[model samples]
Target chain A: MSYSILVVDDSPVIRKMMKRSLSLSKLELGTVYEACNGQEALVVLRREWIDVVLADIHMPVMGGTELIEAMSKDPELSKIPVVVVSAERNAQAIAHLKTLGICAHLTKPFTPEQVLHAVDDVLEQVAQRSVA
Target chain B: MSQVLLAGPLGEVTKSVLSEAAFLFCDELSEGAAPLEARLVEATITFEGATPGRITLRLPWHVACEAAANLLGAEPGDDDVEANAHAAVGELLNMISGSALERWFGSGSQWSLGLPSVSEREGRLPSSAPRGELVALAIDDARIELEASLGSVT
Candidate 1:
């Protein structure tokens, strides 16, 4: 089975990096979608069957915090796991994200292995849920 | 006592942040580009509140090309790629600075980052000055520098 992933970040570099990293990893995933920010991501979410969401916290329009809050409220969208990727090192900011029920927090300047591990952990959980 | 004193911790943090960003944005290990060059692109972001200092990134042409290509997931084919990479470099620097400041000054401190200014070559360093201190790091032989004109001792 293939899983669809949505990558949202204001920086095209980060978006491209995420895409390339995932592709190079050769993860058994389906077509990857991209968005500039959380607002754009929401629009994509409505139309696509996204299994996972990788987002950055500090974005121009509708940041990761707002996106997570919005997703948590929506019954259909909330089910999709949301991972927060950021360079912001404020412990409080991270705590706030955790409070919002973000699946995982990956700090900026992350290694490919770190990113892959996060994806694997989330996907594995999703797989187990289906099996159960 | 002196502005250079702050460079010790600040420089370490800045380098860490940049290194992390480099790893994330560039496929350094896989890509043939071994030494990722990052120049300080002429851009500054101000920090307000209790602890305040400006963060700047200066990038030269070649460094900009490699950085842009890495961020865009495509080789620097034309001017468009270079432009996009320049923008990406600014944002990456902003994020790194913001995160580093937050680390030094708890979360409650409200700070604002100014619009990043891009230049083809290095511009004048901040005027106030920080005891003539300049910090540079070697990333696969590419030299990355971080200089600050820290006003008051923190």
Candidate 2:
């Protein structure tokens, strides 16, 4: 089945790159949504049927931390997996992301294989969770 | 830590990030051979936590176009690449700063990377950032400079 995805980041170039990487890869994809910040992402998450989210941690208005926190608090949104794609390298920052319940973290300048691998891993987890 | 300590990691980080993330190739520039074009743009980002500091990146206008085009798989002069040049440079600054911070400090060091701000200006480094240590590189056949100014380490 194709998976609908949401990509949240302030940089237009990054957003475009992420989309290109996904579309060119072997993953089965559906509609891809874009948001400028965590706040905008929240709006999209609430309205759309998203399978996963690839987000950046720092942005104007709201950030990935805030978005993840909001999702964890909500029952429905919490079920969808998140893969953080960011420039964050601090261990503490990454640990904080783990505690917030993200499935994976890929540092920026990531290769398409890395992105596809992370997405595939998360999607597999979702499938297994459904089977159980 | 001081800029002297950061100098090594800065050089390596810029090269790897440009090559891996931006799809741009770069090499450390030889002294006294720096040639910057008439147009340039700077992207600056600030980080806080164990070490608070600012990292600034300067690129020739044409180099920015090359970076954007590479990132987007478009031609350098393509309209989309031209428009995305600023954002591409800003994102590159973010990646370099994030990697450099971890390599300079410990990986477990607590810190928050800031968003990069980009602006177009004419020629060379700006009047600000006198205390910032600079790293020069030859990228896309143009001079690219990076500077880092660190605050008191906590």
| Overall lDDT per candidate, in order of appearance | 0.68, 0.88
lDDT of 1 by residue, A75-122 (tens): 989889988887656666678888988889987777777888898889
Candidate 1 TM-score, C-alpha based? 0.77
Tell me how each candidate scores on DockQ against the true complex: 0.28, 0.90
Best by DockQ: 2
Worst 10 residues of 1 chain A by lDDT: A85-94
RMSD of each: 6.4, 2.0
The digit string of per-residue lDDT tens for model 2 on A88-115 reads 9878888999999999999998887888
> What would the TM-scores of all predictions be?
0.77, 0.95
Runs of candidate 1 exceeding 4 Å displacement: B1-5, B17-40, B47-49, B70-81, B106-154
Indicate the docking level reached by candidate 2: high
- Kindly report which residue stretches of model 2 are placed more than 4 angstroms away from their true locations once superposed: B34-37, B125-129, B152-154
Judged by lDDT against the true structure, how good is candidate 1? 0.68
lDDT of 2 by residue, B1-154 (tens): 7579887899899999999977778876766774554688789998888669898899988888889998988987788998999999999999998899888887877888888999998875433445678888886457788888899422
Interface RMSD of 1: 3.2
lDDT tens readout by residue for model 1, B34-121: 4333334555555555455666655555665666766555666865676676677776676667665665555665544343445555
Best by TM-score: 2
